[model samples]
Target: MFRAARPFIFRLDAERAHWLTVHALANAPWAAGWAADPVDDPVTLMGLRFRNRVGLAAGMDKDGIALEGWQRLGFGFAEIGTVTPRAQPGNPKPRIFRDVGSEAIINRLGFNNGGVDACVQRVARHRAKGMLVGINIGRNKDTSPEQAVDDYRYGFEAVYPVADYITINISSPNTPGLRDLQAEAALDGLLGALADTRARLADAKSVHRPVLLKIAPDLDDAGIRSAAAIALKHGIDGFIATNTTIARPPGLSAKVSGEAGGLSGPPLAEKARHVLRTLRAECGTSVPLIGVGGIDSPEAAKARIADGADLLQLYTGLVYHGPGLVSRLARAVSTS
Candidate 1:
């Protein structure tokens, strides 16, 4: 069905087409039946059971309006948001661009989300449905870097009760100075603050939810090591191998290749995989890792597992391959 609709969907603006698909899944009841159940490749990591290894990565459903739709579409888990404490319009128009031939997308969409509070309300409605959901939280654009921890803490406190796990997203290149939080001292401060907050919340709520860090692919070797070390020091639960890349690899459509933003898809596979391998090596088997970026096929999925990823995620791949990739990937990783 996606193959048939590709031409028309591609004709529309990339961001518009994306929201249309998200809205359709949210509003169209019949869209729930669009996929078959993914193979049962249960993964027990960070004390949570994932029905399968395949997850819808954070950027795809920032506000998570289609929780039921994601579950029905066969994603074992869906990481929603890069959500901010307060709602923001995000970057200006033409923020998302696609290179259909290369199956790549460059997005400078920023963290355009409907604030953590509203997102929590939407997620609360479907929190009991049993799908593992991770809410990815971020600091708002207007928030100064010095006070980033406060924004993250607010988002953390807001979604702590509902999120199966929480991902601290400081990797998106589109957000100005956002990735700067990955710096050793800044990361230490942020993680330290959140760690203390989590201890309090866990004791108060009497429930513990895993907290994962999502890092950018642009980090250098030294940077990756520092981030991993800090996270381990704070007892962070897991790591999402990479976010999008600012570096434009060769062969992308020249028209959009130079666009200022983060690039995802096949161009990102190598770098993302490298980061995954590095994290696996640095953190060893103790830290669970979620591999994403340019994973458009079963082979890529298998490769990620071999590279030491405990789970896998998809975003740009779905834009090109459609929902069927979920089940296919789940099956591929089930036995690995």
Candidate 2:
């Protein structure tokens, strides 16, 4: 059904098509039945039991609007948001462009969301559904680099109760100065604040939800080492080794490739895998790593696991291949 409908969906604007798909899943009474149940292959990471290792990445369901839908679609877990403490409209229209030829997407949508309060409420309402949900939190666009930690702190506190885990997203290229949080001093300060806040939250709530740091794919070896060291020093629980890349790959459409945004899909696989491998080497076995970037096939999924990913995530893959890709990858991982 999705295969048949994708052509029509793809005909719409990229962002519009995304919203349409999410809305349909959220509203469809039969959406779950449409997807085959994923193979049962459980893995425990962050002390949480995932039914499988193939997770829906953060950017796909940014507002937690379709949590149950993703689980029903065969994902082991679904990460929602890159949400902010306060709501803000993202970049101007046409912020999302599809590179059909490259089977990729370039998006500068920013972290446009309905704010933490709204997202928290949504999670609270759906937490009983039994799907593992991770909330990816970021600062509002207007928030300055110096004040960024406060926004993340607020986001942590707001979603702590309902979120299965929390992700501190500091790598998005759309927000001005957001990537500055990845710098040594700035990252150290942010993670230190987050660690203190997490400890306090754990003490008060009697629950310790793991916090993962999401970094950009544009980093070099030194940068990767610096970030990994900072994460380890602060006792950060894990790392999502990449977000999206600011650099365009060679031979992409000269027209759409020049757009200003993060590029994702096949072009990101090599760089993302390299970063994951480097992080795995640096962090060793102590910290968990969620590999995400251009995984569109069962072979690519297997490759990510081989490259030292404890788990895997997909956004652009789902955009290109439809939901069936989740079950296929899950089965492949389970049997492997």
Clashing pairs in 2: none
lDDT of 2 by residue, 276-330 (tens): 9999999888689999999999999999999999889999999888888999999
- Evaluated at residue 34, the lDDT of candidate 2 is 73
Indicate which candidate wins on lDDT.
1
* Cand. 1 TM to true fold: 0.98
Clashes of each: 0, 0
Off by over 4 Å in 2: none
TM-score of 2: 0.98
